[model samples]
Target: MDRSSPAGNPLPAADRADGGREECASEVKAKLVGAKRWRRLRRLLAGVVVLGLTGWFALPWVMPWPAALSRPVPAGMRITDVHGTSLRRLLAGGMRAETPPKLPEIPKALVLATLAAEDHRFYRHGGIDPVAVARAARDGVSAGRRVSGASTITQQLVKLTVPRARTLRTKGLEMLTARRVEMIWSKDQILEQYLQRLDYGNLHLGPAAAAAGYFGKPLADCSLAECAFLAGLPQSPSRLNPWRHADRAVKRQQWVLNRLGVLGWADADSLARARAEPLKLRRHYGFFMAPHFVDLLLSSLPETSRAGGENLTTTLDLDIQRTAERAVASHLARLAGKNVTQAAVVVLENSTGNVLALIGSRDYGAADGGQVNGAVARRSPGSALKP
Candidate 1:
């Protein structure tokens, strides 16, 4: 059957209705397909987010926490004489170091300067600074080489505790370890450990030592300029040595001060004062006494006990030791004409045979064989043995 309108002829009404329904059904099918695709995409994205969050949360548990942090003596060990005078300080692994300052004793200005210079976002970041990492990446891409680093204080601490060659693998491990460290340690604790073990130039191991070595003063007496000066050394200790490379160190120091001012850690007036202040570097030697005897005593103890911060008192008397050293020096001077290069002396208590003093050599600082303990060394038994 055909239908006719007022102006034109048309197909049957049933056929028209059937065509309209078919078009509507096709549109509905298309919409359904698009919705399914959208849902699938959303699910995929959700899965990726879930996996990322899981990994982020679980990494600290899976990675190994550094054992060095739990140990008490990351700073090093100290050896004192009978009268409580510091004789020598042995570093964490028996190397020589200056006595470290307590964390609370370090000045606030130095802490601020360090934060400004090394990691401004130290408090905000967990273990890594995403902003710094992004900036480093962008700069590296622009320069076609690595011009800077993104390591946080936490990461630096991890690297210090577990030293490794600079490689991608090492960096990844450091990142993981740093994350673990942050979980176990507070910000102040991390900072204390880092500062205590920090190696300043010329064997100055900590803030107190650096202050004394560079300015011939204690950490408490260091001025703001001196604090800023020391806060800038750890970047490259050898290159920024104020003693050897004053210009470089000063430049780095100015940079640190500028950062402090810009970051609001220091006021403009202070920064100005620091910039104008002259840095006077002086060489300060560590307290070194009875070197050979200390060495022998430390060697005899178990390695673990050396760093326990225990004061070891011996029967050796300071007066007797000084007398014995003078005697050895006098005897050596007399034998200087006989080609004799070294001398040792040992003073024993009359009744108990306890060694009151032992002079290993004429001079421990001597270059050639001056550390040889002649008293303990095997020598030809001359008539001297016939007491």
Candidate 2:
């Protein structure tokens, strides 16, 4: 239908031009709104598909962990027990190799403490924990780098087996291997391997050496408090060396106790007492484990030992070695200040020429000097032995 303005004549060209421009503007707004709606719908659909694919692809990588793990000791090598006090074989005993120590010598209380204190989700997560990963990611974002670790107990076991961490490449490889281990081995098997491969100086590997070191108790006979103490050591043995820093050792021990508390393994009263208690420093099993031959054999050993298939026989008459140490210590009071106040004794088999008994010193340590091997170390005879 034709419309007319108030003016009697047909509308002027300028009026017509104004009306056309308004119509054009309305059409442009409609097209722009339609385009925006279409774009938003596309974006929403894309997001859903992406999420679905991500979940599908991540299935293998983020699936639940395995149920069990198999033990991996060398095919025929027996897991030996060598705690010498009882009639049972001692961990470092000269006579017997070792069989595995039963799961928990002390209690679940102590073992859980160590696992929690060192790693809270050790058993619950896969080789690595996602919560830890998220935490690490947050730290990285805020600080421009990582502050926490993502490695799980299994990953640590893999790293532990590596024995060296020279590069990122090596670490990545260890994580890969740890994942494989988680797939194949049971949790107990992994735990056993970790215990077995653990570093416990002087060819004495595993918890056995560690138990022998701190408590003078065999791995199997470790008391509740003692196991907590020894298990706490590997986290930082040197820094918390009981002999060097009694305070550090005590703190670590308490930290372990606290770990027990976290796992609800320790009682409230015991936790409080352990935390408040002063360091009850004790001589480590250094002498008790090896007795007479400890210092001598250690001095003779090279910086690093190679544990190939070669069976090396030591030079010690177990009976005689025990006797010599007792004899020398008893005689110390009579011989305290003769410049040669400290004494060492060595016995050798006449036939095999094996240096058997080597009692380095009455005291476990040297004269405040940095680690002097008192046994193999021969102080000049001082003209004592008449020529």
Candidate 3:
């Protein structure tokens, strides 16, 4: 054909037409692929926008931001000796009081130990730690078990203040609330409140009560070792209680010290010294000298006052309370052979009608209804009431 002469080569019209058709087919295929890519990109963008919108609007409803970060501190009757020194706390309905020492008054060692044990990044993170969470998730997946916790100090504090069921929804709420708590409270303030509100075993709530209950020392007076020991209690308070399981408690304390060492808060020498330091704990029943008197005082308080963290000062004398307890025990011991099993004593000031001492039972440690307040028990005074 004339096409061959133009190019100086032999060519057929059918072949030329076939080549054009092939090129057109390729273009059509490319356009189809491009359309598919555009559709996929559009879908991805739409999904992201929808997710963003959902999170932005749904978060508030899920978390429901609080007006204030203030939580109810556990309140109890802080009965003292006649000379005004703290004798024992009478918890309201067995609830420990949240008597946190002032932040300045709390020992620095204790604060550091607590931070090391509970949340190493307490000062750095803003409520939630994505890195920790991711690591925890990875570890859990690798181990084929959920072994670690990713909750920050703020998140733990939120959980404590606002108890909820353990679920994905609750976790989402906790994350949101923790962020809100961070916004409302300073880091130091949040820490102080957390320490004060934390529960220790044996009905000891807060650092101050825990210090006194476990070590028989004031919060500021706790040694580094003791501080570490106390700092570890909040994790599993009942299981690791020093009174019940001293060895386990010591092990947990060592774990805390190791954490501190890793965090550069303590040196090898210091950690060793702390480990060697023996804990001289003054363990006793939850109720100390004036169990009944404390119970009575707690019962007498208004519900609002008890829940609002009010402290009660009573006329009960610690020394007299001890004496009464001893006398009751002695009389009961003597009467044991005569089938007399229980006794109660109530000593009062005649002039002011103030209760000076109250012995609820012969032995509050005894298993036979020891917790029952004999002083308040309903009894018929057969001949004694005749007068």
Candidate 4:
């Protein structure tokens, strides 16, 4: 009863069953292999993700977060007049003050100019701007040089707060710190701090100092053209120094104005007016008026306060000091023919040791030992020490 094929061969049932079993086994093995491969791939992907997360969270530990950001701003020695107005700022170790003068609500023109000059999408971005970075890269490639810096204001703040050498690692840290800063501070706060800490050539730090140094006015009182000029200095303070290079500084100011116009922040008439506005820059002889008093105040401070940024209200009357200086100069001029050149004067309040007027020398401008403070200079006490 066995079935025969058309070729006249009888079929074997056991051989057919064995062939079917072998085929089923091969299919099962293939499936198991595929499953194993998928599981291995998933594990590899998961490990990569875990490592990336670990690195992102742990990288800050390698360099350690800067403690300077958390500590109180080290304001250098600020010598103030009796009226509490700052007379001179003696920088401690050449470091700027951490707490700058209170800046008024930033002018709209200044804000627009800053945004146009620095980062246009400052309000919209988080901490980093990938689009700007990509564009900078492309531009750099095309120009064969770095045409633009793709740093956000937040990034600049981080760099200013925690200075480091320019490197890949440092830039990575800046980005990480910038993100943390954004999370902790508001956009306005960030901008405020940036404006407060920015440099404006000739050792002028912050808008307040820059305003006074450049325009002989307060930050709140600076005009629009002055504001624009101040706003354009943070990029390269030395190169854009208004004192050394007025023409270049004006050009940069014009550029800022142009940017403002392009952004619709300024109208054509206003822009033209600003461009034509003349800058009346005052000469900045920093800390010149009260040099001796400043030195005494600095020496009297504690080691901690000597680190700078302290506002010291001395018992010095500026008017009386000027009078004493004039008197000394007049007397010395009269005695010039007698071969007497140097003189010192000190006036104190009758009730207290408060110094009212101090003339350290006849003339601070005199070429002969003008810097030697005669008030505290070591000399024979004469008959005064006898009693």
Candidate 5:
């Protein structure tokens, strides 16, 4: 080979060696950069987790905001008809009570039964119950999912009042609201309002209404078994309904009764007997006392009208209400299962919205209001629920 051909121009050995060293250095630097980036991300995630735990455990204080500035608009319930109603019904001194009021005062027994059943420690605990949450967490882990509810009534109130898109962020907001609601309302106030306004609590509507609608008596009159049935409805309103799923509803009712038994409000034998009995729904689902009128009335109203109001009685006649329900139930014998299984019957006085016979469900014990249409919805399709 020629010792020096210009075309060959062999590079110096030093130059080749320097090029190799530079490539090695670049690779080393790339690895170091990646390690640092990974550490930074881990730190960011850690910070988020720490903040959530702090809020959850510490249950940090929430500053009060004015009701006007608060989230929800006013709660409204509109009454349609008013013929024979004593809008001027007297109070203690033969005076009329407040108009557009809340449900009749909660019964002491219903209150006691709920307390005995739902939260024995409700009186003892502040906003959050570490023990209950821990138990629920254990249950969730055991079930391999979040099936248990660790929320207290206070927590539920927070969710109900604070309207937010459901998300992690919204959940945080709910906790924040719950903490604040705890500060503002007393335990009794919270409990009363919760039951009175509880959505899905019953077919006739709020708890007081539900007690009245179901037992055909006042909240004060709920039997131990009946109250157990009502209390259990909140957990899974649709599934464990005493009216439809007499069995499942009985199961849930038993849970409440069991709790009551544990709390000393009831005896084991009483609870067992109640559990074994079938739900005796006073009226057909959604039938109330007057089936045809209710069907006609609900069909006449618009969607906006379902909005509830206190003292909004209908013009239904109790005697006539029974007749209509019997007619339908008798006519649909094959549907006895489906009728009691799922129904919504609301009977009203034709002239007044004063519900003469409001049977929100067939198996008032099990009906989901929405489920029963025993007489079926029988309303106009595509038309609003109440106009």
Candidate 6:
């Protein structure tokens, strides 16, 4: 029952059907393998997405809070005169700025200026500003590099507390920590903390110190111009230092004032006046009188009290100390030709045994054993002490 084709031998329909069946089986197997591979790829992608979501939700809780926030602020003890005038500032560590003021004590103008200069949307944002971020991203893309920043005040505080190199990983951690900080602290508390730890030029740590050191006044007494001047310093303290680079500082201040005017925080008259007002920047190295006496008093105290937060008021009077210093200097000048290289003056009150003045040497700043406590040193009493 075989039939012959035109150019072939006899062919059977059953063989042709068997060959067709084999081809069909091959196509089905290939399709099944492709489907299995697609399923495996989808599973892998789903696992990655799940892991990413889990990490995003759990990062803040897993990351530890910054230790610097919990640690006590490093403060120094103060030594004052009987009239409560500061005679010397003694710090166990590096030099610190003046004590920071509370939120209420901070000046309104300064706050406004700071908000305008640093973060205009500080109150509205949680820890990041989406609008600013988008703008910065777009700008960066156009510039082919990072041209601007979008860090909120909260994010800046986090960065200050936990410093790290500039990288995507560090920035991600900073943003996460900033969110956590905002959740833990209120708006006022976060702002106050930021002001307390903010670095303002010349070792000044806070606005209080900046006011005192730069303006020779309290934070509450700072004028609008002064406030603007100080507000501009936190951007680049060293570069905009009022003492060192007044021109740059004034430019920055003008910028802040302009921002304030634009924000309607200050009227035109006030902004104009601030721009015209001259800042009387004071260069204060802090009161450093009665060095020898202060040394003795500190030596007598326990290490804890010397470096503690408490201020010590001594029985010494500042006026009498000045008088005694002048008298010693004049007398030493008179005896300059008599080989008298040193002199010690000690003034005591008759009513009380308190020391009115104690000068250890003619010049405490001299390099030749000037720090020797001559008043307390054992020496033969000359004719001046004759009975």
Top candidate when judged by lDDT against the true structure: 6
Query: The CA-based lDDT of model 5 is what?
Result: 0.58
The residue-by-residue lDDT of candidate 5 on 1-387, one tens digit each, is: 223335777656776677668988999999999999999999999998998776755554553443522432223332323344322111211111122124246555456666765566776776677788899889989999987666677767666555568787866666566666666677776776566545433444456446644555555666767877777776676776556776786677767777777777776777777667665667422223333344556577675554433344556555655665676556556676564444445555457555655554444334355434445445566656568
Model 4: residues with Cα > 4 Å off, grouped in runs: 1-66, 95-99, 103-108, 376-387
Instruction: State TM-scores per candidate.
Output: 0.76, 0.53, 0.69, 0.77, 0.51, 0.78
Candidate closer to the true structure by TM-score (higher is better), 2 or 5: 2
* Decoy 1 TM-score against native: 0.76
lDDT of each: 0.82, 0.59, 0.80, 0.77, 0.58, 0.84
**Candidate 6 Cα errors over 4 Å, as ranges:** 1-59, 301-304, 333-341, 349-353, 366-372, 377-387
For 213-311, candidate 2 gives per-residue lDDT tens digits of 455556666555665766677676668777777677767777788778777877888777656645444444333434335434444656334122123
Q: What's model 1's overall lDDT?
A: 0.82
Per-residue lDDT, model 5, residue 375, is 51
Shift in Å, residue 97, candidate 5: 18
Query: What are the per-residue Cα lDDT tens digits for candidate 6 across 48-98?
Result: 898866654556666779998886555568789999998886653565556
Q: Name the better of 3 and 5 by TM-score.
A: 3
Looking at model 3, residue 237 earns an lDDT score of 90
lDDT of 3 by residue, 186-254 (tens): 999889878877888888878887887787666778888999998999999989977789899999999
Name the candidate that leads on TM-score: 6
